[model samples]
Target: MTELLDQVDWQGKLYSNGWRDASGGVLDSTEPATGAVLGQVGQADAADVAAATARAAEAQPSWAEQTGPARAALIRRAAAILSDNRAEFERWLVREGGAVPGKAAFEVELVLGELWEAAALPTQPWGHLLPTSEPGRESIARRVPLGVVGVISPWNFPQILSVRAIAPALALGNAVVLKPDAQTAISGGALVARLFEAAGLPDGLLHVLPGDAEPGAALAADPSVAMIAFTGSTAVGREVGAVAGRTLKRVSLELGGNNALIVLDDADLEVASSAGAWGAFLHQGQVCMTAGRHIVLESIADEYLERLAKRAANLPVGDPHTEQVALGPLINERQLANVDRIVTETVAAGAEIRAGGNYERLFYQPTVLAGVTTTMPAFREEIFGPVAPVVVVRDEAEAVRVANDTEYGLVAAIQTGSVDRGLDLARGLRTGIVHVNDQTLNNDAYAPFGGTGASGNGSRFGSQSSWDEFTQWQWVTSRKEAHGFPF
Candidate 1:
């Protein structure tokens, strides 16, 4: 087992031997599952943000000039380093993010895969020749990277989300100033820095300045940052988008979700129930794309809820690092309280509590609720925890209506016997990623990942979609002589 360090050792520093305090001292993180102090992270404030931005600005010009293949090589090396240190990386995620060991390992592997995919972006074919009017006229379009990107990643999938944004930004030859969530600041920030260093990347190409919204907002508003990449709640995302928009800086946001799963009357009860429980409860239901608001056919609503409750109860809740533990604590005390309040309020509003709603210590046992309506807060809001509320729908039409009744359009799932019905249901749902007869939470590198409406503004993942997100295009035209004839 890897031993937790009391404090992070700053691998690189300014000209002055002593670390500067533009960001003040440090922020402490505790492992919620065990109530143990994970470690302290160096915090960055407004001054630190400025310094990091300055470094990124200095590094951007030369980096942009380098051929795409050159940057790809560094990213490939970084992927190799990540593969070599998978165990240590997994341990850090489990400690810092309360991720179960298996899920942590899987997420770290996904991050590695994303890094590998991002490397190919450098040398990948881009641009095309376009036809133009007149004999001597010619036109072409080519893609270019945004200079320095300000990335604010969330705590849910700290390792994967941060790496996803950073890998692509770096591969495109852009300098990055990353602001990881305060909860995972120390471990997440330090580990990401190490990966870049191990890959032998340029000194200032990637910098981690872990801080709160102040520095993050400042980064978004900074003139030096050409783009802002953010992943968090819709409320915060909107603020970041507003700031970035004001500055005319390009931005990509993956935000809040009150996603739903529709189970048709003809669906397989066992499979659908199992998928629903896992989708709603995994990562303690902290995923922005979780299917928390379940829309079930009235005919099978009772049966589905019962099976889901049993499956959720079977999941062991204990130390995150234990192999037997399928689920773990909420990220912190605040998250637990928030989840409890939402569930309690829903019950007070006449919703049936199907399973666990009690929180022993910090763990909120996987909760299931029936008799939920779209009007209830738990059903409408993004209660990002281990709570699944099953809302009975009279028919497929009602399911569609209820699923699309939210401000969020992130992801949705539908389980149906008929392919035609499933396709029709998927088309009707307002979500970006739609799953038929299965769970909606799987991460596919080849496919686009993102949301719509308040869920998010753009797509991400190790896909062609991700490539398009961080780039802008320019058109070029040439003519031997003036094309237009004038009288």
Candidate 2:
């Protein structure tokens, strides 16, 4: 793992144009579970962002002019390099991002899929023809790259979020300036730089800056950047969107979610319990699609709660790098404190902690909360932790009402014996993504992934959605003879 760091030159240097020292100095990337210093990461400031964006602006045109097959070959090479270093990347994810081994492996798999999907973008048909009303005229509409794209990614699932934007933007002939969260800079930003560098990507086409909010804000407001792809909390996303909106730059925001998993009366308790546990507890419930609210039918609420509590109580929590645990530590102390506060306050507001409401250091026990109401913080807010708040509803109508009550409309799930009933309830719930007879934690590289309302703008990231997110339509017309103007 240390060798991987050395290979990538992860010793206090940013990848702006090329590997160089950042003016803002270096910060230590530490393991959250044990507070061990993994390596030093260069911190980029406003000036670095400007320099990177300017360089990206200069490089984009020629890169765009490259033959589609030529650009695609490089993207495929990057994916190959990522595959070769899969084990090292997984270790880094476990250490820097505090992800469990399984979660780390899953993230890597998703990233590889994203890379492969992006590689196909260059060769896809990007334009269409339309009939013209006038004689000797031809009209066409084509999708063109948005020049330079600025990517701001979060620590949770850092690599996937960053690559989902970066891979597509680069493959679609747009240069990128990426600002990864300081906490998981290596896994998110620097490592990406190394992969592209190893794959023989052109210098100045991609820049990796690992830093605090200053560089991120500068990147968002940079005039040379044509678009901003942001993924984080709703609060931060709003700020980024506002800044980008002022400049009239396109922005893609994949923000927070207070998602739900509905378990109907006919749901198989055993199967639903397993799915619910995985949905809420995977990655210590740090996912945006985490099933924070479990709305159950009143008839089987008791049995469902019992089953959920048992699963929460038995799941192991510890350092993922050294232990065989089901759940890993939260990203840092701030996240852990936030999770604890929500759980404590919700309990005080009359919710019952049915099982496992405790923590030592950053490893929080998977908690099951019963008798939770919509007014409680755990039920209303996006609790990014392994805490499941179960709410009882009289019927499917009440379940849909409770699910749609929140400001977030990111994702939802319905578990029932009848697929038709589950699908019917899914239609009534107001969310961008829904899973019938499944849990809320779902994503695919070949499928559109995003949310509505506070969760995000209407932008999505994946498959054909990537084409829409990274490019804009330009209409072109040609004629054998020029038409006279109606003066």
Candidate 3:
């Protein structure tokens, strides 16, 4: 047990200005794979959340006042520290978040890439100059930090999701107080705080308040926080957005998805099937951008579904810590029950279960369902599990129509032969990210990543988009000659 979960600092406590116990008491962090007791983590309440945010607020101005290059250097140093501690971070993911080795390593590298991405942001142009109409007057619109940001992250891909926003917020000169999900307190929250602190970041510049929704709500509603970056389900995001709206605070949400990988008639069945299998089963399909729906043309439906099922079954499924498992256990028993419910409903509704559907404790087998209808829960909602639902469409037009039928507009993928046709269909996708020949599970650090409609707010991350989300615009005008104005 020690060998499996070694290198994790699970002396669970709220890490604010420094380590402290939660006034609200403690919650046990368990390994979903083995149900082993990981540690007792401190659970912060509203007041604890307030204290963390207050400390961040106090440190923001000074951090923001630092030179842009200086800030970039610090961010780069943090990235270096993460790279140095890669093994420990990977262990934390497997022990705390139940991530398989491959998935755990992928997420760790992903967050590191995002940190390096933000390291360059301090030098990017955050504003532009416009042509002024008045004589001797210059107009410049510049983006400034929003002071302090509150980050609420979910259990799946916790570190990747939280730091995706946190790195950019810090690059833009905003201090952050992150409230990671109770399940990912150590991996997502404390790990981040540790890295930045090791990299010589000032105390109170970033705070990790590991707790439940009570602290999350308090952070979102806190007057000191200027913005809230939340990554979770649409239901919870709606509540977070409502609170942020009431407070008139800036909010960026990366919510749920019912994404599709549309395989047109001209698509290569083998290639398309592999892409679909990987996308749907990676990280147990907990990823928001995973292609849960396979909208394949009727011409290739049988072949694609058969191949996907075969690949899914062959994927190594075992103890994530001991074996080379591709699909790990769900985060906890709650997720196990949720996935079981959806698969059961879909099967009962005339959908054929083509592959694995059994569950052992928190470990759920990767499942594939065919003949799925749009109204089915498996097709309509975000499954957040390693379950693929196949929906056959008549043609390319119907494929597009069926894919766009959902309220989610997070990610859409198209696999087609003609480059022109692929480009055309990509343009018609209502989602934020569209993959022409690839899977929907593409999250490159250099790209502009986000979603539309219920999937997320219009806000984006990565490149220039990240800076835009954490900053406020200010217009400035300077005149060399004083002009007299008549009142």
Best by lDDT: 2
Q: Per-residue lDDT for 370-432 in model 3, tens only?
A: 999999989987889999999999987888889999899999988999878988988777999
Give the per-residue Cα lDDT of candidate 3 at 161: 90
lDDT of 2 by residue, 84-196 (tens): 88998898899999999999999999999999999999999999998889778999999899999999999999999999999999999999999999999999978888889
- lDDT score, residue 61, model 3? 93
* Stronger candidate by TM-score (2 vs 3): 2
Candidates 2 and 3 compared: the better one by lDDT is 2
lDDT of 1 by residue, 76-155 (tens): 99888778778888887887788888778889888988888888888887788988875777899988778888889988
| Candidate 1 similarity to native, TM-score | 0.93
Kindly give the number of clashing pairs for every candidate. 1, 0, 0
Which stretch of 10 consecutive residues in model 1 shows the poorest summed lDDT? 11-20
Residue 96 in model 2: lDDT: 95
Error of 1 at 135 (Å): 5.0
- Distance from true position, residue 235, model 3, in Å? 0.1
User: lDDT of each model, Cα atoms only?
Assistant: 0.82, 0.93, 0.87
Residue 250's lDDT in candidate 3: 90
**Which regions of candidate 3 are displaced past 4 Å?**
1-10, 136-138, 480-484
